[model samples]
Target chain A: MAKIFIIDDDEQLLRMVSLMLERGGHSTRLISNPVEGLQAVKEDKPDLLVLDVMMPGMSGHDIARDIRANKGLENLPILILTARAQEIDRETALKSGANDYLSKPVTSQELIEKVDELLSQPNQKMMPDRGVIIGMFGLRGGVGQTTLAVNLASALRRISQQEVCLVDFSPSGGQVALHLRLQLRHSWLDLPPLADLDWLALKGNLTLHPSGLRLLAAPQVPQLATEPSPEMAAKVIDLLQKQSAFMVIDVPRLFGPAFMAMMERVDIALHVLTPDVISVQTAVQLNRLLEKSNLKFKQKSYILNQVQVDSQIPQATVEKGLNARVASKINFDPNQARALSQGVPLTLTSAKSPLATMMNRMAEVINNRVAKRSGD
Target chain B: MGATHFGRNQLIHMDMFTDAYRVTGRVLVGAGGIHAELANPSSSFLELKDAYISRIHQPGEIVTHYKVAAFSKDNINFIVLQDRREGIPVGTQHGRSIYTRGRALSVFLTVPSFEISGEIMHDGKVAPREILVQSVGRYQLVFSAKALASLYPQISYSGDLILVQKDRIGIFCLDG
Candidate 1:
């Protein structure tokens, strides 16, 4: 049974709620005063908290805000209980960081069900006014992370109506520029030294795309495997974020110091994997590394990139192996190969294509998410 | 790394729960809170939507999940609620108005598998026998009550208020 803590001024209500949950086979702690209740929530660290809206000194909203502020308790699921079922009251509770709410007259079964539902969910606590960096990479070669990067950047450029940049961070060279057909005149190699590389200097090295998207292409030669220093990589990413409203990085699967520095600034990491045994195992290992390491992406997960019409393994099997849901799934497009050779993104050339439509929709979602999260 | 969360398909699953986990546990399919089935209070059994049964040892894990389940009221140990004023069932009244004055004292009662201790607010007299004889309800209020296992004291549960089955109380004690 889950350890549930309830904070309410009404002794009768507390007893009723406790008994109801206990029937559902959960152990509960009932506190009559708000002050003691808050202390117990912090010290005990229960699986969930049910708080009352109106108490003598501290309201439920205030307690929620305090719990959210506490570093260890920030993600604790809080259910607000209120005598007043007004819309405004709910709004207040949620703003103070309540996961869910129920009005005063609650049934025994309903209370049990809500508590279980909240327990089943993972807490998604997002801070306001933050920028986003979307990184795309696959542990196994030929899994289509570069393709996604190029096409997504093109689609985002069209949809966002704002500056969008696609960066190829492969030290040993990558297919990003090949897919975009950009001239190999400038790359991250052309940027000035780290201390001198301001946005203007970096801007001069970026190849401008016809779609108003910019490209920070990788070096043309595989022999010149010169990876940027961690500081240099962080500075470049920071500058890129300041200049562009949206940025997509075609990351190479190298968990070096540079990669770690860049990941610290990446808000989302989309680890692409094809439907195959080797690909799924590689993605699983990558997920384990991301979870164990102090990597700083808010969302470190994977996207299922279906490259073959007949995959070696099914999506269900892949999900079972990784123990996570695919953040997105992209089906293979027949014409994508021709588009890649022509140095044009599929999203730019074929808006009517299924792959292009998916990219466009994803771009729209990312755009809205960034805008809302950035507090626009 | 927590519970497996689906992007699109999981949302549809939650919508199914929204159907089952209504505020009243009654499937209010129609607008303005109307039950999908006609209410029959005269029946012996109560209906529960989306009932999940779990063992006491592994309460977090479900042994069986049901889309619907029925329970006979006569078999239930007791019922509890936050407020008695929501609507006193066709049974006897327990609470006096908030404006009335009362003295609080501890009471202990026992039912089938558990022994319960709670405070009762007596309005007029403090006589233990007179309080029990004068009470009119089959269900009595036990505020801040804790139920301990009759066999194992280590296993205990506490709740804010319990509308206990007064008729099932095998033993009752009142503190001076």
Candidate 2:
């Protein structure tokens, strides 16, 4: 029987859900308080937690935030149950670290299915450990760095269902956690100190999403910057594949130890650029920087972000100026940016957006690239 | 185990704007009133500093408490009371936007909520004349104020921007 913890301030709702789970042949613990719910997860370490979105004291969302911060119990599957049946509410719950978001008055069958789905998934350790390392870099801010990185990773997971890890390298300006609306307590900086590089130690630092994606968020604090040596990053990527299939690094534009080292071992470097002159200029400069590092330039591909919009520069003009064939182009959707700032990916927020389709298409190209590279 | 609460500190730790309080009261006028009496540290307009002024009203969840830096001679920084949270509706389906802009691209958000038609603005003016909400959410609004010029030195420059919501008013600080 799966041991589940239900946290909610509503006694009636909690009792109903708990009884439902119990009837479903599962052992359940119900807590009506956020603090107690957190404590239950930490001390009891249940298989899953059914959290309430709105709580009188500390909210389920707040408690989830604390749980993600608590490295020990960070991996616990959280299913948020809320009365606020709004898409933004679901997105908020997901971004706040809930594995599954179910509105209040959920059907007994659906709850059971969600619980079973969460519990049936094999533990993190049971998964296969192999993947590719792709680094996505954008020279300018608002060039859709996090958007591209999150969607690319999701598309990869959707197509191959393989292991994928998305690393947010922008420590100072890092929005990966914010973009995903992940209420993580600790980031890569919080990884337990390593005596030396090992697979288990590195795996401990990862925050796995219910979507089969793992994330290594940049440190939220600027002072806590951890620049893994190129050797260390390469080693981490190499070892992470044992647990993950593909590792995508959202490389921060800031030139430093981490960026330099990650670019060195990146199997494919996807340089993100807009049609703007400033973006192209930065892209060219970044391309040159990558070249000077002696990393294979031929493996690099240019992606024109915001290509669907009426840009200040024409696509043809940008192509002629950069003199590089664009590998892929993603459409511009204001809704996408709104969704992201509101803390949800395009795929999760609005699938109808053209950005989602392009990202999916881009994922196919990358998959083929990986296949070709593996063959070589 | 069935968990219960003892109601001792049930409402503890809900202070979102202790540093910068949230105010949703009308613009009070006092003749040289003391800073303590006139300024509600909880006012949302108090947090306006070097921010981009806009007129666009997009509804979303917002933080109510605004930190008061300094008040103008009239002992007023803004004209209206403001709600901390708003909900803008998404597409035909049920969803909304939740975000607040700070100086530069800094968006100050604690948790993003989904709703439609955000905090209503009865009638008021937003600075940077160009500011106007393009899309409306449950509690959030998308406003455009690119045409409005920056605020010049004036009385009651306490709040950076002002937005009128239904029965409630909001003073804001929007970043470009």
Candidate 3:
């Protein structure tokens, strides 16, 4: 449950709001004065702050403005409570630093809904500054990174408008097409010689999606020659940026020119692992290899793809062994395999799916980073 | 890039579509006083008539605080006026203009809305100027000018300017 702090002068209103939040399964800390509320926030550092506009000593607006001005609390989401619903007043409150403004006499339902919305919104604090690139590979085979990748991309798309490119770079096991259930139109192997590849040709080569996104599928052929080189992969990334924005390269697990080249461009490298010890051991080796490369992936970690709710290896052990944050944990869902077999990204086909939601959150953390960097 | 300044606090600039007939200019008269000078090309000779600030907010592409004015006969009597406190929505203002049967220009606060016939007025007096007068209530006015140039080719320019005054409002200048 999330921790919430309420600041208001009205005793009745404070009690009512506190009760409302508690019923929603959230912990609450209420303050009758604005000054004390600000002090509590600095000292206690609650997950969320609900501020009342009309308060004793200092107004909610003043307290909110102060919190926003404070470098440490600037990113904290502040819900301003006001009696006036005037357009100018709301606009003024927003300009001062409030993330959201509400008129007084607000219903319990509205308060809870607003609070839930604020909390669900990935804390701007948790947002990573760079796209965390996760590469999924199986111990034996068919571990399902393609499905995870597509669904993860879709989930991220829903959260924000950042452009996401899903690259089917898997050399032989390139099943992104099979997972998305979309017929493969073109592949890197079909690409014109690297010398001739430009923005126009790149656009013409990659299918422009109706969703205003782009995808580069891996060649369907098996064991064919003329794979894209590391240099070509770098060039493709450059060209991809010109065509769209963020990219999710479905890199082959086996190391090669393409894999090494793509790794160079990645900001956050995520190695997908499963519940098995072998998979975990493989992830450890991969992390060590990555470190040998001067820790190329700044925040490198393994995602327990298709992890069962009751896994043999506890999350703590995995985190300690990997020496990296678990980053994200996707519990096994019955529909996950079905979603993949049906060739649909879980995020789009079954957004309500629990596994899909987790992946989407993961993507959100990554997308937030890209957005913050660009915003900066 | 062309920009059309809507009633104060809204600046619309056209940098999207490419066309020679694009509208570009800043309304100098806004707030409580009028002080408009053509910064680029250094001169304005257009005239306007039946100018007024509307209280309506157009729903679609054009979001403007309209300034409707009649063109003087020569199209060189440039008039600029400021309506600082008059608050009007686009729909109501446009509806009122329609009821009054006035030729109105929908100033797309984000882009240029009108094309002027050449050799327009530069001074703020020659063109008919509509000044919105009110401190906290709705107000609108019309000033008519003679048709200045009926034979000149039609030209369009779009630009928005920030008007600094006692009251903040978008400014529009017209030349006949």
Which candidate should be chosen as best, given lDDT against the real structure?
1
Docking class of 3: incorrect
Best by TM-score: 3
**Residue ranges of candidate 3 with Cα displaced over 4 Å:** A1-142, A158-162, A208-212, A224-227, A298-302, A307-310, A363-376, B1-176
lDDT of each: 0.68, 0.56, 0.53
As for candidate 1, its clashing pairs are: A14-B160, A15-B159, A15-B160, A15-B161, A16-B161
User: Model 1, range A1-376, lDDT digits (tens) per residue?
Assistant: 6899999887998999999999876899999989999999888899999998666566677788899889988668789886544344465576677777887678986687677656643234442133357888767888888888898899999888898888888987767888877768888888898779898899989999888998898987675687888898899888888888878898777877887787777776777899999999988787678668856566665677878877788777887898865556667788787897788888887887757876776776567445433442
Error of 2 at A172 (Å): 2.8
Candidate 1, A216: how far from true, in Å?
0.9
Native contact fraction (fnat) of model 2 = 0.00
TM-score (2 decimals) of chain A in model 1: 0.66
Model 2 chain A worst lDDT window (10 residues): A120-129
Quality of candidate 2's docking, in CAPRI categories?
incorrect
For model 2, what is the C-alpha lDDT against the true structure? Answer: 0.56
Position A77, candidate 1: lDDT: 78
Range of the 10 consecutive residues with the lowest summed lDDT in candidate 3 chain B: B14-23
